[model samples]
Target: MTSQNSRQTLIIPALGGLYARLNDGVETLLRVIAGGFLAVHGSGKIVDPFGASEMVEGLGFYPGAFWSPLLAATEFFGGILIALGLLTRPAAFAGMIVLLVTVWFHWVTMGQGFSGAEKSLLWAAALAFFVVRGGNRHSIDARLGKAF
Candidate 1:
């Protein structure tokens, strides 16, 4: 049987063997860290789910009462789902949307430009990655033999 390393080497004549072994672990690490931080960041907001009503309303998401709780849940619960690798794609997509809004808020609303929105842009990129990759083999989605 061809081992994973050997297959990797065949696919890429150099470096693949060395790096392929770490792919899943690194992906998992990134996912966990991103999701964990997102959850923590949203923890305070989730505590008072309606607190961001005015803020979301400012963003044009009518009915601040509805958007506020949704924003909180998307950050907190979606973060948990991402971290657990359950429904990873949808969760990451939600995160990406939130990050995109932050990017807009910082760059356009606050007029901070790239300097202020850089972090949110980076986060959006990471979540975008997860949205496309849909978790690695070590994820719950993989174990369940399905992903979305």
Candidate 2:
């Protein structure tokens, strides 16, 4: 076989195998990035717990007392869970909901449209993917042999 043919048959397949082997690690990395961002971004609210009350209420979620801490927990604790790959689906699903709400707030209430809401939209999509795919083999869920 020619050199090019050998490269295709050998190198390409080896690369493919490597990619498959690292797929779980890639998923874990993405989860860490997303979850870590959420945790850091929400850290302030977690400290106060009521910091987002007015904003959340302004978004029409009323009873700020309830939602304020709930949102805080979802971002903080939920982020921790996601990063640890423990109960990933539920955490990601909750994060998805929070991000969607932010998307609406930015797009509709703030009149920022897609430009302002783009980050939340992307975060929501990432959370949604985790919600569906669950934790990969490198995750705690996989170690426990249960995703839900």
Per-candidate clashes come to: 0, 0
Q: The CA-based lDDT of model 1 is what?
A: 0.91
- Judge candidate 2 at residue 104 and give its lDDT: 91
lDDT of 2 by residue, 1-148 (tens): 3356445656456576676567678888999888889888779889999988998888888899899999999999999889889999999999999999999989998999999999999999999999998877778888999879
Top lDDT hit: 1
Instruction: Tell me the RMSD of model 2 versus the true structure.
Output: 5.4
lDDT of each: 0.91, 0.89
Please give each candidate's TM-score: 0.89, 0.88
The local lDDT score (0 to 100) that residue 118 gets in candidate 1 is: 100
Clash pairs for candidate 1: none
lDDT of 1 by residue, 35-136 (tens): 898899889989999999999999889899999999999999999889989999999999999999999999999999999999999999999999999988
